[model samples]
Target chain A: MAQLSYRDAVARGIAQEMRRDERVVVVGEDIAGAGGVFKTTVGLLDEFGPKRVLDTPISEQAILGAAMGAAMTGLRPVAEIMFSDFFAVCWDIVVNQIAKTRYMTDGQVSLPLVIKTGNGGGLRFGAQHSQSIENWAMAVPGLKVVTPSTAEDVVGLMAAAIRDEDPVIFCEHKGLYASKGEVPDGEIVDSLGTAKIRRPGRDATILALGMMVPRALAAAEDLATRGIDAEVIDVRSLVPLDTRTILGSVARTGRLFTVEENPQLLGWGAEIASIVADEAFWDLDGPVQRITTPHIPLPSADSLEDLVMPSAESVASTVEKALQS
Target chain B: MKLPLSEHRYGEHGVVLPPERSDANDALDVDLDRRRQLYRSMREMRTFEKRAYDLFMKQLVKGTSHLSLGMEAIAAGFGAAMREDDYTFATYRGHAHTLARGVPMTPVLAELLGRANGLMGGKGGSMHLTSVEHGMMGSYAIIGAHLTIANGAAWSAQYRGSGQVAVCFFGDGTTNIGAFHEALNYAAVYRLPVVFVCENNLYMEYTSIHDITAVPHPAADRAPAYGLESIVIDGNDADEVHLAAVTALDRARSGQGPSLVEALTYRHGGHSRADPGKYRPSEEVEAWKAYDPLTVYRERLVRLGVSEDELDAIDASVLALVDAATEGAIAGELPSPESAFTDVWADGGWSWRN
Candidate 1:
């Protein structure tokens, strides 16, 4: 295993997939010559040639719709929607057409399409460009929502997304792109609905997703120092959520706390809480606590933004509250 | 002045039309079988539409069904001419296209009945019928939504080196939507293999086509502007519709380019079962009904040596099949409530959140 950044891992996965299959091609606004906005598709234009690495028009609708079409016609197209927030512009292509094509066709046409975008709020990028709207995508059925928390997860999940016979919305946290992790030299992790245990514990369970997984781990370590053993679970796939892992972890710890960067009202936290309440209510000794951003549009100020999203401190506080209850 | 014939020949014919063989004898030889198929397909669509109208009135179908009764030739002609592997995207009133492409009537009827055996596994009703095996890409209930998808499919075909084509079937009103312009422009810019078959039935629900748009023609004369070939045909005539489709399909398959076929047809029934076409003038409806594609085709077939008994036998066969399918559909089971969440994603499984 070698250490690799999220950006490098994504580039490697895309390159590997393209190299493995001639049908695989990459299309985005600046994916060709400019190597994408974050350079995730760097050197792909030169390595795979122009046909395989295409720079499309600024229209996100066209890029996504064309990707669906390409996938339907036997070509595996990995389309970049730039920022995750930009997915709003292509709802007809992404939600109505691409996601539901197979079911609509009675399982005849499989849309092996992947839409890659960056999520989460940080880097002082402000609201519009840096909102964690992954829950919005997860709300829609027929779409596989994924947020790889680590570089290793990125390589594995992205390859799996490309090869799978369904449309996958592959989200990468912009904050986690520079975070380095040791990825298996070859692709190893490739399950769709399985969550990974980032850190094991017994006193309490902290279920998190995307960039929040690492923060949850940090909080788990901090809680361990205080003799509070907290288990950290990374929800890699949002749509096809691994309920088994979550319920298993929740059963061990009678108390549960969920953390999410999304808003409080309808975030993944609310979903997780509801699932536990509906199915594993007897296993919980106390009410399930959820730590998330306020249900308001993200503010531009960095100071206010810091308060808006769930932090390690907020998670620990929520966990402590759960323990007291 | 009459247009000069091209040097190109099809099946031992001399150059007649630039895109098609112009020699009457040679063209006749090649088009005989195609013409017969077009006639039969259009007849089938007309029969299906008329039967559906009867069923809707009798309350055999729960939801409203859109009948392309008068405009049968356009769907049959263009759809039949498509290559088996080529793609087709259509609007809500897409039953005729699906039938022309040979999707069994039983599934279509079952879908109207909201049965599990339906095309969309009972989720989609009359408006969203789709069959991938026959290349009938799902029809969109939202007007003009399928245009972009069809354009994408065409571009994909070109990208994949399949030499296949795509046909987008939409009503005259769809031309005014943003998707139509965007789709056409994209297809033109990339020289995508596609045909835009605009069924100009002269109304969008209750509104006449003239009231909503400045352009008189459905596609207008925008073909040259978009750098693609364009043609307007009498949609009531199966021969004319088939001929136009053949020309467009040939151009698309041979890598020449895309074409915009404006089929001037009329819808005999209301937009949906709920509307009795109250907005249309009685005289206008009467005038268009005189040129009923089904009747016109039957008359032509009579002139071509098909006896009245033969036509009756064809009619009986179609009616019996439709009746059987309708009965089967009504008897079919509705999908279980648990089925609501089954097809949302692949079989790996996901948690539901209210």
Candidate 2:
């Protein structure tokens, strides 16, 4: 195993897929010659050449439309939307066309494509650039949504997403781009709809997604020192949620807490909280708690941004107070 | 919110129209068999649409359907010009384009009735017709979106050295949509094999396209900005459309990049079954109806040395085909309840759980 940054893992994963399947191609703004604006797709243009790696203009609809059309005809295209916030510019392509085409065509056509975007806040990119809009994609019926917190999951999940028959929204967090983690050397393809039990415990269950996974783990470490054992679960894929892992953890701890970076209203955690309330009602020792950014646009100030998003300290305090009471 | 209407935007001559190319077929070069095929395609489309109108009157048609009542020549012309492997992406008023791809009338009609034997097993309804086997890629209901999607198909063809062109057909109003311009610029930049066909049928639903649009010819006028040739043709004449389609198709197939063609025609009927088009003046309707594509094409066939007896035979056969298809479509049963739960995912199940 070698330690790789989360951004480098994205390039590694795409290179693996492109080398394996000739049909795989990448299209986005500055993704080809420039190696992507975030530098997540470096070394791809040199390895795969311009034929496999393409750079397009700032037309989100064109980028996605070309990707959708290519997928329908026969080419596995991995397109980028720059920032998750820019999905609004071409939501018609995402929400109405790409997401609905397979089912609307009644399975005659399948789109095996991936739309990777820089998602979430804390980098001070302000409101337009940094919103955790996984909930937006999750609301659509025919889309697969996943966000990886670690480099290993990034390489593995991107492979799984590109190989899947459906369209996947791969939300790569900008906040975790510089973070490092160990990734297996050869091809590593993980499964979708499966959650990883980051930290196993017995007192209470903590569920987190994307960048929140690492924070939740840190929160678990913080709570352990306070004598409150916490089980931290990484909710990797949202559409095909691993209820087996979540429900099993809930049953063991009899208490649930969701740590989310998304805004409060209709956050992904809201859905999990609802699910736990319905299925694990008898298993609960207290009310299900959701620690999330309040329903407001992300601000650019470091202190203000930190105040809005759920942190390791906030999660620790929330879980401790709930478990102790 | 209400906006003031200019005096130039109100009467029989409210919309500025393209000049008629009355001699569009002066030097047209189509052989005997090809002419018959074009005539037959337009006839089949006309019959299918009339049958759909009848079914709607009977309350048997499932949902809102847009028809190509007088726009058959555009579909027939491009469909004829396109190679068998070439892709077609059309708008919601796509029954003609779908039929032009040689998809049989029975399943197409059945799909309109929401029947089990329908093309999509009654899931897509009248708007979203798609047959991947025949290369009728999809019929998008939303305006301007498919133009961008068509670029992808063309881009894929270019990448794989398939030598296939994607012919995307949409109404004139689609030019104003944000995606239309983006798609044009994208296709030209990559030199992808795509042809954008705008069926300028004078109206954008109820509003006159010319009044709302900055330019008289919405699509062709925008071509220079994208470095494509601006082309406008007589859509009522199959010969004119076929010749133009061939030029554009050849341009795209040979990697000369994309071409934009605006076909000038008039909708004889309203936009959909729900509209009677009382908004259009009777004189204007009558004047336009005189240039009916099928009638004019049949007359043109006689002038081109094809006898009336041969034309009559083709017409009789088309009527019989439509009659049989209507009967077959009516005989199909409602889709099973279990079908609703299927096809939501590639696994043929709608499970979102682990």
Candidate 3:
């Protein structure tokens, strides 16, 4: 095992994939010479050369469109959208083309492509850059959405996404880029739609996604001190959700709380809560609680941003409320 | 103001027409067998489109379908110019494009009829017909969106050191979209092997190209901005389109980079099946109809010493082929209800429950 930063782990995964498969090419704005804005693709240009590592113009539509075209013609393209907020600019390509191609073509075409983008907020990047809009992509049926919190998950999930036959939206949290964790040596590929139980308990189950996974784990630790055994499950893949893990935990604990950084209305957390409510109605001891960002745009100021986003304290308090009820 | 013939307008833009093949030497230089094949392709497209229109009018086809009534020459020309391995992308009016690329008429008709035997298994319908085996990437319903995608295909070919060239068949109005500009710029910068074929059919849906475009000729005026060599041709003339395509494909194969060919043609019918095209002036339509690509090419074949009896035989064969395809498509089965749940993911596993 080797300790690596989340950003380094993602780069390592891409490099390893490129080395293994010559068809894998990376395209994005400033990803070649500049090594990407977050340096997640650092050293790729020198190792793979410009042909494999392409720096496109500031047009997200062209970047994604080209990637889709390349994928159609037997090339595995890994495209990086600089920020998830800018996904709106190329919504037609993503929603109509990339997501719908395989199904629309009736399996005649397979788009082995990956669209990696920085998601979530914490460092005051403002409304446009900070919002976690995984729910928008998650709502789309064909797309596979994966958000890795730790360095280990990033490496494994990134490798899996590159090798996946379908288009996978790999959402890398900007807040976790500098965070470090021990990753297993050699190649690691985690299956999509499988959630990992980070901590095991019996009082209630906390399903966390993206940046909220760490917060949920911390909250579980806090709850343990107060005689509350809270189980924390990190939802690695949002689209092919591991209902088995989530429902099993809910069945044991008889309580569920979904934590996320996105808005509460029609958010990823709400989807989880709805699923638990529908399937495990009798399993729940109380109403399925959702700890998420309030239904408002994230503010630019640090204080206002802090007030909007969910925290470990909020998760703990939400769990306490669910347990009391 | 009425739009003049595209050839007449080309001189005003200082666009020099490629040297035309003289009629005297055209018979000797052009391969007789290839010319016959090109004529056959045009005839098949014309018959198929007319049949599709009849089906739509009879309420047999489910959704609206676009016809390439007068734009058959461009499709036949590009088909004659490209290899079977070369990738082709087209706009919504792409039936002729796929037919010319060698996609069977039965599956093509089946797709329009939304049958299980369709090219996309009744999923894509008319607007999204694709045959990857034949190198016809797709027919994008969204206008101007496929330009960059075609550019990427060309980039992949170049990266792999493949001699293949990617071709995009779009309309004149597509030039006004931002993706067109972005795609052209990227293609030029990367020296990708792609040919942007704009079938300038005068109208984008109901509105004339003059109303939407700033420039009269997109290929002649705008292509130069991206450092691409642009050629303006008489789209009704199959020989001219074929010559231009050969030149562009050769340039792309030789690593000379991307080029644009704006084929000046006119659609005989409305953009979609429903409209009667009341927006067009009757005189203008009549004037353009005088130069129907099929009629012009049939006369050329007669002048080139092809017997009238032979031309009749070719026409009869095409009609028979179209008839067989139409019957087969109508008799095709409907997709199963469970089919809606499949093909969304490569793993054959849809995340959502039924």
Candidate 4:
């Protein structure tokens, strides 16, 4: 085992998949020689050569369209969008074409492709660069959306995504890239849709994803010291959500608090809250709570950004509120 | 991944066929045979579309379809020009193209009727028919989306030295799409083995090409700006279309580079099942119908000694085939809703893991 950052884990996963299958290729703007804007694809071109690691033009539609064709014909492609906010430029392909091809083709074709992009807004990147659109991804039916909070989950889930015979949106939070953690060697890891329990507790359940997972874990630890005994569940995958795990945890705790970086209105937290209410309503002692980002564009000022995103203290307070309610 | 053949020719003879302006009067015996085959294919497509419309009126089919009634010659022209192994990417109006490529009328009609035996196993209705066995990559419903896909296939073919060309079929309206420009630029820069065929039918729904694009004559003209070889042909004439497609295919296969062939044509039918084309002038429709591909080919065949009786027999036979396919489609079963979960992935095992 070795210490690794989220960015490094994503790189390792891509490198491993490339090594395993010659058909696996990486394409994005400046990902080859420039190592990607976030350096997630650092040293990939040199290791895999130009053919396996291509530097594509800044046309997202062309990039996605090419991946669709490549996937249909047999290549397993991992396309990187510099930022998740840029998905607007290629929505037609993603929503209308890529998401519908499998069902439309009646299983004749499988889009064995993975699209990777960095999201979230804690870095004061402003509205365009800082927006967290995880809900948009979750809304699509055919795509499998995975959000890994730790360096280890990043490597594990990304590897599974590349190997899975379906289109996957492997989203990374820009705020978590440099956060370090222990990463085990070898390809052995957890499956895609299974949520991991970060901490076992009985007072209440705190469910979170991506950057929010760390905050939830920290909140759980802090709550434990105060006798709250909050259980922290890291939702690694969103689309094929681990509902069973969440529902079971909610059943045990009799309370739930979901955290996310996106705004409170239609954030993925709303989906989780609704699921718990509809399926495990009787199991809850009080109404479920959600600690989420402010329902406004991510401000450019660093101080304002700090105020907008939910921190560990905020999540802990929400869990305490849920427990007391 | 070398292609099955490096260079293909008409028979064993090494005679060079005329380029855009093929020897009009000095045609070879093989050329005559090729033209006859082209006529037959176009006739079949024309008959198929007409019958499909009739079926739709009778409420035998569900959903809507984009027909290729007036553009039969373009399908015949391109289909005859390509080799069996060459791939084709078509748009929503792709029935004529698929029929000409040898997808039986039965599955296509079955698809329109929402039957499980349809070409896409009834999954893809009219707009999304795919026949992998016939080298029909699939018809994309998105306007110009397939252009980039075709470019990628061409790039792969070129990279592997396959000598095989992938032909992408789109419409005049697609040239306005960013995908078209980006795809053409890539094809030009890489010199990929791909032929971009624009069946410029003039109208994208109610909007005309002249209203949307600055250069409307041959969308192929835009190709030359990207350093690709471009040609404009009479899409209503099967002979002209076949010659243009043959030349483009030859250039692409020989590693000369990519070519754009714009076949100027018109759709006699509405855009889809419900489009009555009230947006356009009646005079305009009447004017285009004068240049109907079927009439032009029929006149050509009659002049060439294929008597009226023989032509009637061909029409009757095609109509009979269409009727039988429609009846079979009506009798066929709808896909089990359970099949909805079926092709979501390549294997049932993969879905289970998720």
Candidate 5:
């Protein structure tokens, strides 16, 4: 095991995959000589050379389209979109081409490509840069959405995303880039569609993703002090959702509170809440609560951004209200 | 409508076809067998498309189908020039392109019919036909989208030292899209081995290209901007298209970077089955019909010592093949409802139902 930051873990995962397979390539803007904007792809160019680590023009449509094409051929491409907000620019390539290619081709081709983009609203990057758009990815059918919370999970999940045959959108939170945690030194591949129980409890189950995972964990700790045992579940994969784990936790706790950094209306949290309500409605002791950002663009001011986003206090308060009901 | 004596034409719009070399006489040095094969492929595509048009008119084929009635020469030429392993990508009007790439006629016909035996298992209809085994990468419905994808394929070939080139076929309208420029820029910068073939069929759907685009020569005029070598070919002449494709593919394979080939042609049919092409001028249509690729090629073949009976026999054979394929595809079974859930993911664990 080794202590690594989330960014470093991502770089290590990509590096390891590239080392193992010559067909694996990394392509993005400024990912070559300058490392990535977030330094997530640092040292890749020097290690893999220019052939594998290609620095492309500032065209998301071209980058994604090329990556899809390469994936169609024989290359396992890992493309970075700089920020998840820019996915809108390449929306056609992702939704129309990438998502539909496999199903449209009837299993004739497999797109073993990873689209790594920074997501979430923290660090005051303003409206354009700081939107957590995991909901958009989850809404797409063919795409596998992975949002790892910790450095260790990033390592495992990134490895798995690189190996997945389907196109995987790895939504790395910009807030979690600097966060440090222990990651396994060797090969670690986590299975997609599995949720990890961070803090096991019985009072209420808290399902969180990306940055919300740490906040949920903190809220669970705070709830423990108040004589309430809150179970915290980190939802790593959003598409092939680990519904079994969430349902089992909800059955044990009899209460559910889903948390995410995205907007409240039609967010990924709502999908989880609806699933729990439909599958385990009778088992729920109270109505499912969702703690998410307000349906407004994230502002540049830190205070306003904080107000819009969910915090540990907010998660704890939501849990308290659910328990009181 | 008569064949020009000079073998070169420079229009006021900057469209230029270079004069034929004196060293090359009668069919650009292509052997008789290859010429016969090209003629057969073009005839097959033409017959198949006409039959498909009738099927569409009868409401037998589901959804809208785009027919390349006047653009078979480009597909046949590129298909003949490209090696079996080289990848090919095209726009929605890609039935001829796919057929010329050597994909079996049954699956393509079945796909248009939306049967279980279709190329994409009835999932991808006429617009999205793809056969990876034959290097027919995909036929994208979206304009200019597949150019960058083709660049990626070229990059893969370059990276793996696979000695393979990727050919992207699009229309003049596609050249105006942002992806077209982006793809060309990247292909030039990376020196990727890709050939961008523009089938300038004078119209983009119901609208004329002149009304939409400011540039007269879309491919040639734009090639220099992206640092690409450009050529203009007589699209109606299969021999000219084949020679141009060979030159471009050779430059790509030799690591000379990407090039653009603008094949000036016209679509005899409408953009899709729903379109009647009432917007087209009657005189323009008549003028183009006189230069129909099949008719022109047939006359050239007869002049090149191929008997009239032999050409008729070839046409009959092509008609028979298309008939067999159509009958088999129409008789094929419909896909099970359960199959709609399959092939979405490779792992096979997740289903659309969940």
Candidate 6:
């Protein structure tokens, strides 16, 4: 096993897929020679050359639209949107065009492409730049939303997204770019909708995604010290959700809490909460709780941003108070 | 291992020049056989669109449909100019473009009728007509977006060493949108083989394109900004558009980069089935109808010594084909209730759970 950072894992994943398939190509603004603004796609241009790793104008619609068109013709494209919030500029390409192309064309054209974006709110880039839009992608019908919490998952899920014969919204948290984890040396690939039980416990089920996973695990650790055992499940892929694992966990632990970086009201947690309420209602000992940023535009100030977004300390305290109550 | 770069395939046919002044009666490179084929394509598209309008008028076609009633020449020209493997991305007014790619009329008609035998099995109606096997990639309902998509197809062709050219068709309104400029710049920067054809049909939906647009020729006027020559032509003249299409296609296939051609035409009908088109001045409509593509082409053929009987025979045959397509479409069955659940993913199922 090799220790790799989250950002390096992204480049590794893309390179692995590109090496395997001649049809694979990557395109985005500053993703080629500049190695991407977040530095996740470093070395792709030199490795694959300019033909495969293309640097496009600062056009989100162009980046995604080209990716969709390329995928329609014949190419496994991984197009980056720079920032997840920029999907607003070209949401039509993503939600209406790419997401619905396969179903709309009656499977005549399958878009084997991945939309990689730096997602989440921890970097303090403010409201426009930093927003976890996975919930926005999940709301779409024909899209597969994937958020990898670890370096290994970053490589594996990205590989899976590129290989899959459908458009995948792969959200790489801006906060976890520097985070490191042990990744198996050779090619690594993981399924889209499988949740990993990071820390298994019996008292409560703590569901998290992207940057929230680490904090949830840390909170679980804090809860363990206080005699409140918490189970942390990294909810990797939202659309093809691992309901079996979630339901099974909820069944074991009568309490459920979702840790999410997205703002409250229609966050991914609400959907999970709704599901647990309907299916695992009988297994629940108390009402489901969602720990998320308040329903407000994220502030860039470090203290205010830290206060708004959920952290390990906040998660631990919330879980402790909820379990005690 | 990395893939090798592609070399140019269209060696002899280099840059294709537009008519010096956008005249209809420019010196033509077309022969009688080519003219006859172009005439057939135009006739087929014309017949298909007329039948589609008739169906919409009868309330048989559900939802809404955008018809290319008077915009047949542009589709015919590009469809003829493109190879069998070339890709086409058109707007919602795509029935003609779809038919031009040689997709049979029956399935297209059936799709409008929302039948199981439809092109997309009734999943995609008139607004989303697509036949990838025929190289008609898709008919995007949203404006300006397909331009960028065409660039991607071109990029793929360039990457894979394929000489296929991607042609995108949109209306005059799209030229004002950001994606149009973005796509043009991108295509030029990367030197991707793509042709952007703007059917400047005088209107952008309900609004007059001239009123909202900043430039005179919506697409061609802005071509120079992206290092492309601004070429405008009489869309009513099939030969003129055909020549322009050949030029752009050659330029793209030969690795000369992208072209933006503005084909000036007017739609005989409203944007969609919903509009009665009272907003258009009667005299303006009358003047444009007088210069209709089919009428102009028919006159040109006659002036070139083609017999009246031959043209009549072609039109009659086209009408008969449209009739058969309509009959078959009317008889086509509705999609099975369970069929809607399929094709949501590559697994051919809609399940989102493990």
Chain A TM-score, each candidate: 0.97, 0.99, 0.98, 0.98, 0.99, 0.99
| Chain B TM-scores across candidates | 0.88, 0.94, 0.93, 0.89, 0.93, 0.92
Worst 10 residues of 2 chain B by lDDT: B1-10
What level of docking quality does candidate 5 show? medium
- Give the least accurate 10-residue stretch of model 5 chain B, judged by summed lDDT: B14-23
Give the number of the best model, judged by TM-score: 2
List the candidates' TM-scores in order: 0.89, 0.97, 0.96, 0.92, 0.96, 0.96
- CA shift of A45, model 3, Å: 1.3
DockQ of each model against the real complex? Answer: 0.33, 0.85, 0.66, 0.50, 0.66, 0.81
Residues B1-354, model 1: lDDT tens digits: 111112222222110111221122222322555655766777677777776777777776677778888898888878777788888888889888888778999888888778888877787778888888889887877766677777668877887788889888998888887667767776776677888888888787788876767765657455566776556676776776776788888888888777888877778878888888887776667766876777776676666666889778777788788888888887888888776665555552334421
Comparing 1 with 4 on TM-score, the higher-scoring candidate is 4
lDDT of 2 by residue, B1-354 (tens): 001111112334664332332444745788878989999999999989999999998999967999999899999999999999999999999999999999999999999999998989998989999998899999999999999999999999999999999999999889998999999999999999999999988889888887789986789889889988777777878888898899998989998999989888888888887899988777667766877888888887887788999989998999999999999999999999999888777898888876
Candidate 4 versus truth, CA RMSD in Å, comes to 6.3
Pairs with backbone N, CA or C atoms under 3 Å apart (clashes), candidate 2: A66-B152
Give the top-scoring candidate (DockQ): 2
Interface quality of candidate 2 as DockQ: 0.85
In TM-score terms, candidate 2 sits at: 0.97
- C-alpha local distance difference test of each model: 0.78, 0.90, 0.87, 0.81, 0.88, 0.89
| Model 6 C-alpha lDDT per residue in residues A1-325, reported as the tens digit of each score | 9899999999999999999998999988899999999898899999889888888889999999999988988899999999999999999999889988889889898899999999998887999999999999999899999999999999999999999998999999999999999999898999999999999999999999999999999999988989999999999999799999999999999999999899998999999899888898999999899999999999999889999999999999998999899
Pairs that collide, model 3: none
The global Cα lDDT (0 to 1) of model 4 is 0.81
- Candidate 2's C-alpha runs over 4 A off are B1-13, B16-26
- iRMSD values, candidates in order: 3.1, 0.8, 1.9, 2.4, 1.7, 0.8
Expressed as tens digits, the lDDT of each residue in B201-235 for candidate 5 is 87877887766787777777798898775577778
* Residue A233 miss distance in model 5 (angstroms): 0.6
* Candidate 5 chain A lDDT trough over 10 residues, lowest sum: A316-325
Docking class of 6: high
Q: Residue by residue across A1-325, what tens digits does model 2's lDDT show?
A: 9999999999999998999999999999999899999998999999989999999999999999999999998899999988999999999999999888878788999999999999999899899998999999999988999999899999999999999999999999999999999898999999988899999999999999888998999999989998988999999999899999999999999999998898899998899889888888999999999999999999999999999899999999999888778
